[model samples]
Target: MTPEERSLRARLAAHVSWAATPDPASRTAKARAAADSKFEREAREMHPDASDEHIARVAKHLRSAHFSRMALKAAARRRNSATPKAA
Candidate 1:
């Protein structure tokens, strides 16, 4: 019930609130769908006369490339984390 106790409780509550919130930048199905849609729109704009199949192929290629890069980065991070740090 002291002032210091109240301050500590407020800090803990703030930290918990932050930790409970999902990361805004984390990838999710919805985010991936949005990205796919954006890529398809861009492809359409670039090749207005292209067939739907071609546009879909282009979007698939773009999405695969994006995922490949993400995988590579994740692998690199895992390797780095596994390495022993110099004292």
Candidate 2:
């Protein structure tokens, strides 16, 4: 079994079911706050002379890249699932 599956099973056996699902507004707020915090923390390393707009653009590019990669993975999974399995 996968490690995640094992971990999930262990969590289940341990009777640990504590997942936090924030509201839309709360989620947006949390995401914005986290982005701001991260930008501030890594400002010097991200770019000693980078402006706020540059940082924002970089963040946007990263987000888009991640989303595109995930979409490609999902599409690949669907394509593989549709093909006939070899014996």
**Error of model 2, residue 29, in angstroms:** 3.9
For each candidate, give its TM-score against the true structure: 0.55, 0.54
Q: CA lDDT, every prediction? A: 0.87, 0.73
RMSD of 1: 8.8
- Model 1: pairs clashing at backbone N, Cα or C within 3 Å: none
Question: Candidate 1 residues 33-54, lDDT tens each?
Answer: 7888998998898789999999
* Residue runs of model 1 more than 4 Å from their true location after superposition: 1-32, 45-48
Candidate 2, which segments miss by more than 4 Å at Cα?
1-23, 31-46
Candidate 2 residue pairs that clash: none
